[model samples]
Target: MNTIKTIAARAFLISAGAIFYINPAWALLPIQHWTEPSGAQVYLVESPVIPMVDVQIDFDAGSRRDPAGQSGLASAVANMASKGVMAAGGDAALHENALGEAWADLGASFEANADRDALHYTLRSLTDPALLDKAARLAARQIGEPSWPADVWPRDRARWAASLKEADTRPGTVAAHAFAAAVYGSHPYGARTTEETLQRIGVADMQAFHQRHIAACRAKVSIVGAVTRAQAQTLVATLLARLPASADCATPLPPVGEISALTAPAEQDIPFASAQAHVLIGQPGFARRDPDFIALLVGNHILGGGGFVSRLTNEVREKRGLSYSVYSYFAAGLHAGAFTVGLQTRPDQAREAVQVSRDVIARFVAEGPTEAELRAAKDNLIGGFALRIDSNKKLLGNVANIAWNDLPLTYLDDWTKKVEALTVADVRAAMARKLQPGRMVTVVVGGQR
Candidate 1:
């Protein structure tokens, strides 16, 4: 294992009437793991570097699990969860005010977000014993006792619908929605929030979705910073214990259907009034545990993931000056996600930009990265690994991903070794096997339809 050098002397700090030791070398921090009686998996990294603790709790309760025709139910639930809970013993407004006051007194930060495969609630608080206790209890109450208050539903729904309306007017948003619908077809992954779908959602729908999906069995907790093993365990257990102790949360999501091979390249053109045309290209990519994950990750960096040094930038931005920015990425999700290359350029230049990007991708798939490019990618990835987990917040996010995806505990520890072992041939073989340029779907918004 590659170990980061440790500090010869630890520094001491004082905050809020408490003394704490800061570890300068946090790269080697170990993740401690365990399970609660309620079947919630917990991963903790005890770091005393800061007198703060960060907790992230995730459940398999995102939009992918939404009932047919209720596309935004999960997002609605996530948004309302922090607003109020039944444990506060009041109506929606009262409970919301009470929770806000409680969090203010404890000086804690809380956030919730929903994506395709999961819903997450994150909390950050000073690790002073009193503050930590209060924060943890409040977080638990919010998670386990969401009220989904009926009184607030209309207002919240209106706000969400209005936001969607605004987003729909943007060319990039229109293109993205169209691209997803075209790429995934009837798969649940293709579902996007529309005015029609949002109108169909009721508070009862959100409540039912929460009850069926956010159970203890599907929870994953990640805690980091200024806490002991016992404290972390208790924190996670307390938060999740109130959830339904069922064997499973809900029926498993159906597999995303494979993208049909393209007979002719697919394209969608949406006319809009904008200075530049927004373009999106490519197709379904890979899942979290794809065998070619590491290779794809490294290869993507060389191709487009690396900011200014990427081939996409070299071709579209640096050489031809087609756009100010161009990039590509494989969005790995619970199922096969999209591998997309996106850029915005002058209306007249949009088609040429797309062609240039495609040419770059085709050549990359055919020839792969050079020996020097592969070495640079590995060195950059390995050398920068420390920065990725240097902070407690960063480590907590990584741990949450590992837990949610059922990745090996040593995933972080083994990351360097895996990248170091990659060769030009590995990247070539993986890209060749996974990417098919001829079958990619392309979407352009803002140009002539």
Candidate 2:
């Protein structure tokens, strides 16, 4: 059978155009949570509508945890994991080809990736006991026994570095690197992977980094799909069984210090030959843990995040026709991440576009969204809230986010209520507290006077 046929046959045999009705109560579904014996935090949302299950395990070993000068270690470790697994305890090692075939045969998939804030392993498998049991065992082997294949890193590293080299030649890449450096300063978030950094990493380094960080205690596991609390518990145990136990759960990963504030306005006009100028503006914003999250979320939508309807787009893109798109976002994470406003414009109108965008932001921060804007933003956001958790993957992401940020279980259910309750004054107050328009960093690339 082809992949699609096999997946349906294995996971669930239903209609071709199956209408799986997700009960509205599912949005308010209680997130079942518990701590595994290994001290890993577990969050589960039971959706019996389908026979497939989605699982994600997060660890505090993202790029932020990379050692100084080893900028891409976490990513490298994650990528190297699928190359193969080392042999352990009577099961002869499976080569990469064998491993791929095993997963395909079982009609399941596993993936690993490192993001700015964390490393994640996600598995999607049928709830069929036969398929799920084998998938779990195979995933465990990949997670706990990544071979860091000696032959793989050198070839991968060469390709990676060459790609980075090619990317550096692009104007957007140049602008982004500069913007990150300016906003983040000496923080790890500013660190970029370079050919030199890759040279510092090797197979041994990946092995060492994985051993040091991939402990059971640091994992926050999120599950959504067809599984009971008991089954999830067992699954969690089985998946993490081969991982090194946490040495100390109470003592957290040493805090990577927060991004410092911009004390003075810094402006850079990078000369490039590109046709359109890339302009980036703003400074560090709030953290995920900040109580002002809801206010900021709503406020940002009115400011620039809400497309076509935002103040920034209206002011910078609509009226003057300076650029096709203008937007802003808060990269809130474990610490205060960057609040970035960006757009591209004709080289001649770069300065004007930049000024207009900044003016809009300053006004928004000072005066907040107008009552009409607030009403519209709320209506739009609240109306679309259901779509956020409409599917298994989306719900899994919400649960994982809730788990990662240590949010209350009712956070999703209460999301709309909070958004609706927000007043223009509330958005203004939060924006005022978190932003200072004057002290922002302004970057203009490929722009001329």
Candidate 3:
């Protein structure tokens, strides 16, 4: 186990009589990192508090790498990596053991979020040295040597396809699909995996895909647990040793943007389904590297990202009583992704809710946040910054964001100061530059436009 450091917080009262905290100077929770011989980027932070370790490997083999006409190929490759990789024994025993321990697990996931960049594999284990070794080995094997059993692919494909079919009947999912396509027409980020794509994928295809995308250079490794810096390095090296050399096929990701508004209305009538409707509206916003990232984050918090305190929630739900909830957020992915606003309402209230949401967004674009709103947003953001890095998992996530986005090391340290210094002018300027109400792509599900 390694020594863990504590972070202190200092609080003060603002003019509005609200208590807020100034950034505290705490011992650095240093993210010790190095590139493995195989070229995999490795990061580690030790916490002796709990006898557990969480490891994540992010790859460039996201949806962008999918072949044309095979919209969901990238997802299929990511999903299949876990089905008895190179090893003979299946995941059955592993699954049961995970349930028993309630502490260890492994998974392969593809997040095809618009504008975001990578897919990832996550392995978690208890501090027991043996368990940690086994988990890391298994993760490495899954990425490096998936056998893709012929017998298993059929069952997995059938189940996955059926789930996709089921989701197609849901209005919320439909709206999301349409909105993504409208926002990212020709860009790979907009592609949605379908049943046909899944059916066409074979073991060879997955193997080839992994070989090309899951290179050491593309891997972003994150670790947080009861281990020292030395142990962390050994763990990463031992697990990733088997991976093949980096491939020359890796390419820089391209940016996605739209000059005008894109709109598409998709209607689906699920026989005898419930009496509710869902809608989504959005457009490309900012990348993680944007200088105004924090500014927009605070702005979105006041717009629709924050729950009760956001302007969208207040106007759409509290003031007019239109929908249960309405929220907006921007995801800074490998490229700049959409700024999305979404809501759900009773069938009868759908139109009113959509109208109200648009009206509020338009007003926000024009007026930005008031001085009072800016003050509250700053206080809340600065005060809450501590909570964001309170846990190992969260700390690992922060490190991953920093490494993946190529951000400065001073980011986390300077977070509060950045938020605290934001003024009305900053928020208003960010709104004008990023928020695009008229150009937003809107999708209404289970409702007539």
Top-scoring candidate (TM-score): 2
Alpha-carbon shift of residue 399 in model 2 (angstroms): 0.5
All models: lDDT? Answer: 0.81, 0.89, 0.69
Q: Candidate 2 lDDT, tens digit per residue, 190-211?
A: 9999999999998888888888
Model 1 alpha-carbon drift over 4 Å, by segment: 1-25, 87-94, 245-264
Scored by lDDT, the top model is 2
- Candidate 1 lDDT over 260-364, as tens digits, reads 444557988788899999999988888877879999999999999998999999999999999999999999887888899999999988889989999999999
Clashes of each: 0, 0, 2
- Cα lDDT of candidate 2 equals 0.89
lDDT of 3 at 428: 78
- Model 1, CA-based lDDT: 0.81
- Model 3 over residues 84-202: C-alpha lDDT tens digits? 54533354323322332322222212121211367776666555554566556666666666666777777878998999999988777777788778777777778787888887788
For each candidate, give its TM-score against the true structure: 0.90, 0.96, 0.82
